[model samples]
Target: MVEGYAVGIDLGTTNSAIAAVTGDEPEIIPNSDGDRTTPSVVMIDENDETVVGQPAANQAVSKAARTVQHIKRHMGDDDYAVEIDDEQYRPEQVSALILSRLLADAEAYLGRDVDSAVITVPAYFGDAERQATRSAGEIAGIDVEHVMTEPTAACLAYGLQETGDADTSESHEKRHVFVYDLGGGTFDATLVEIDLEHNHIEVKNTDGNRRLGGEDWTQRIVDHLAEIAKEEGDVEIAGDPEQEQRLYDAAVRAKHDLSSREQTEVTVPYLGPNYNLETTLTRETLQELTADLLDQTIDEVDELFERSEHAIEEVDEVLLIGGATRMAQVQETVESYFGMEPLRSINPDEAVALGAATQAELMSASGDTTADDVLPGEEEDLLLVDVTPQPIGIELHDGDFAPVVEQDEKVPISRSDDRFTTVMDDQTGVRFPIYQGQAEEAEDNTKLGEMVLSGIPKAPAGEPTLEINFEVQSDGTLEASATHFESGESVDTTIESGVRLSEKEIEQMREALPTLKDRAVAGAEQKEA
Candidate 1:
């Protein structure tokens, strides 16, 4: 049976969008309330109703505490959270709300259930964040046809231009391309080689910064204005909640305007009945503030270029993804870095989702009913070769981390390393901290979770040969299994700390959304925040 209405979703840190291929053409479906792009904001109503998109983002300023945005960045980490009226909410639950809203919006437009969808994520996102995204999709009732890399997905959208060509055979047999993606909230550079022979796309080398993006640049501009406000009057705008919102709102406007204009002045609204204060900021000043951030992105992009083994000019296309690419400064920086005009053909907002939809079409057409699709030449046995975005390892005897799985290792793969017992007559459960990133020390990488292996049989320190095996599935989920070489005893489990909040946490946040919302619901809120 043909998969009905394959959908592609770009579940972004700042904004999210859903699109689908219409028969042979791609089309973005309007959200339930009749809008094209949906804000990646989630809010709760006074009646315990969960809301998403602009509505939730609107609350971000007022509720400031409850409405969660950029939760995508905190995926896999346990420390990040949103507390409302003294109750704590997990990032997973927050992301789940966003997914739910997307589903409701898509279904509302199509008049059908959207069970299967291909979601796009940052190529740099580790096992934890990728897994979190999957769980969010699951909770939102998505079948999660596949989780395609954002850059790879963008390539799918761009590669369509070469389709239906007479020379497609030569182009399909192992073509090389570089995907440089500088988006809002994250940056990813990947080397992708398309093998039409196997009808597969492989990511060669990946490099990026999780905390760097357009928002980081935008916030830096906001900081400059705050400084200007301080020096002009030794006054604090952020300290005053009312003035802070207006100032930020104006700053965003100025940032967008500067994308085309050389300089734009921002005037903030005056607070209090006296209405005595006014502030101005310029585009040049904004660039000055984010110079360092821009440099960092370029450095990483250069590193990826070196690893991809392709020169800057050799890049087939420089596809820009994310809303932040609208800034002229970002566009200019990219042009200078690659020595070419970046392709703005793909809607920074819709490109990822379109690529995602195209992947779903491929997955469905492959004739595999399950999430894992049909392999070439064989029905329902696709071989996916994915790699660890960052090197994963544990700390050794000294401060340095020992690589269990080297960076960018292939999937459905495993390796075992022999380890000596840490202590004499140890009977306690062995806890191994799993981390992802490119740091010489384990502390440098993001600690995803702890894997605990129990009942070691109380062996002498020097007597046991512990064989630890690290395995990654086709879906990019990781699991570590350790066995006592002597007895062949083994243990396996997930690495998540109980940090995944209980159902009670979800209930309270949803319950409080409305009360907090009504107090601040003075304007039109986006249907999906």
Candidate 2:
């Protein structure tokens, strides 16, 4: 049996945070380093021991090849793996190490074991991505009570912070909020409706590019500096991982400094003997270099509103929910497009984790209750209604797509399609290739996995009727089943995702946690010594 209270985790790409609900309030749990946020970086030292967080991040320049950063972007990718010391680690495995570090700190702070948590992810993530995140939690020895969206979590924190002590019986103003989340490695534009009076929050629509974020902007700066280095110092920074990492660190510092100052100097030292590349980056130059990237986020916001029933004018408040939204260019563009300044009462970097903690509290109180079943009685009682980020369906005979669950559809839902029939006589099985996308052609969309319903009675073509059902949980996990009309035979589905780890592998990683934890502690001690 698990012990201790459930906590909330914001497993970010660049930085991760953990929070726990204390009495009626949620508080961010600082790591062992006494920091609210920990860098989502991991490195393997010369001793072949694992090191995580700030120490790992600090050594990236010297151990570039052994360092793993921004592993969140590769979650659920089949071909993506980080190789260190000739050993390959899956994305979830790397993510688990980070989660382990966060939980370890939380356990030490609370003086108790933490076995359950609610993790947040990008609002636009699909089933595979959500599954990978859950797998990471399992591997870290935590029961992932729920996998909530980042935008929704932000709204929860905002709403609770504003009305936590207010009377629930009184009527409050209803507001439509637009959440523009530009994080380290992913972006999401979500339109949410917050009814504090009714204690309800619903996600109306969401869209984003998972591959685009602040890192892309940083890369633009890195490229500019690299070009200058080669031209002036005749030093080759490109294709050299160590030099590239050094420049990346410098570029990130310059990016943050430029956020507040008009200009900041960036210097990459020891690139070569008696050579140091120095450059001055101005705020205007940073804006100019990353204008297109900023525009891409605005484009996603426009697309989000286009697909939503509420327009920009209908949005009563706009909330910026990620650290990347601190950029002046991002603020200017968002203000210009929405004609309103975004609300900044809540801390952007900490909102998601705080909200996740609030969610864990609610889930703990209302055991096994679904989101829709949550009612407003106390000030803390609120319903969070989320939706499927993408359409999921099966491939038809002509290679066209047939959607069973459309995009933006409210989740914790089940839908069935009985239009499928046997194409060949005496067919004992029917293979259903599941896909997630809005493409008209099956091949154009992302194939999530496949489920074959076997044991169908032999019959002539078109004689056997099959009813395929799809059920999407609140956490965005998908399960399927097929029922034969005449025989009353049913076969449940188990989607074999190419990018996800198997149950056996997850258990193996879970079993190895103690050994890894010891190594991490030893590595940290070694670094300090």
- Top lDDT prediction, candidate number: 2
lDDT of 1 at 393: 68
Model 2: per-residue Cα lDDT over 169-268, one tens digit each = 4425777988999999999999998887667899999999888988998999999898888888888887899989988988899888877789999888
Clashing residue pairs for model 2: none
Cα RMSD (angstroms) for every candidate in the order listed: 4.7, 3.5
- Predicted model with the maximum TM-score: 2
Clashes of 1: 13
Q: Name the 10 consecutive residues with the lowest summed lDDT in model 2.
A: 369-378
**lDDT at 426, model 2:** 95
Tens-place lDDT digits, model 1, residues 299-409:
887777666556666665567777887877778888887677877667778878877876776676543343122212222332335566887766654557777887667
